[model samples]
Target: MRTVPVAEAKAHFSELLKAVEAGEEIVITRRGRAVARLCSQRPLTAAEVLAPLWHEPLDIEAPEDRAPEPVAEWDD
Candidate 1:
C-alpha cells in the first residue's frame, strides 16, 4: 500500500492506475488524511478474459436403427 497526496495522485493518475494493475494499493490523502483508496477494478487472468468457464454439452439425438436388407443384386 502507498499513500500519496491528492496533487500527486492527480499528476500521476495514469501511473497510479498502472501501479494498481500491478497489484499495488494506493491511498489518496488530503491534508494528511486518507480520502480515497485505489485498487484494480477487475483482476482477471488471460484465460478468464478469453472464454467462459462453463459450456453446456451439445444435445443430439441418435438416428433410429433399421434392419439391414438384401442387395437388389441378390434378386438377379
Candidate 2:
C-alpha cells in the first residue's frame, strides 16, 4: 500500500491512474487523514474478501454442545 497527499495526487492524476492499473494501491489523504483508495476492483464475495489472509484446516474438531437458554417473551 502507498499513500499520496491529496494535492500531489491531484497534480499527478495520470501517474496515480497508472500506479493503480499496475496493481499498486494508493491512499489519498487530506489533513494527514486517509480519504480514499485507488485499487483494482471490489471482491465478488465475502469469502473472496477474507480468503487472502485467512486459512481453514481440512480437518477440525467439533465443539461440545451446551444447554440451550430459555426463550423469553416481550410485551409492549
The number of the candidate with the highest TM-score is: 1
Show the lowest summed lDDT stretch of 10 residues, model 2.
42-51
- Candidate 1: which pairs clash? none
Write one digit per residue (lDDT tens) for candidate 1, span 1-76.
7999999999999999999887777999999999999987887567544445447644679999999987765554
Could you say which candidate leads in lDDT? 1
The 0-to-1 C-alpha lDDT of every candidate, in the order given, reads 0.85, 0.82
TM-scores of the candidates in the order shown:
0.54, 0.54
Per-candidate clash tally: 0, 0
> Per-residue lDDT of 8-53 in model 2, one digit per residue for the tens?
9999999999877766679999999999998867434665445566
Cα deviation in Å at residue 9, candidate 2? Answer: 0.6
Q: How accurate is candidate 2 locally (lDDT)?
A: 0.82
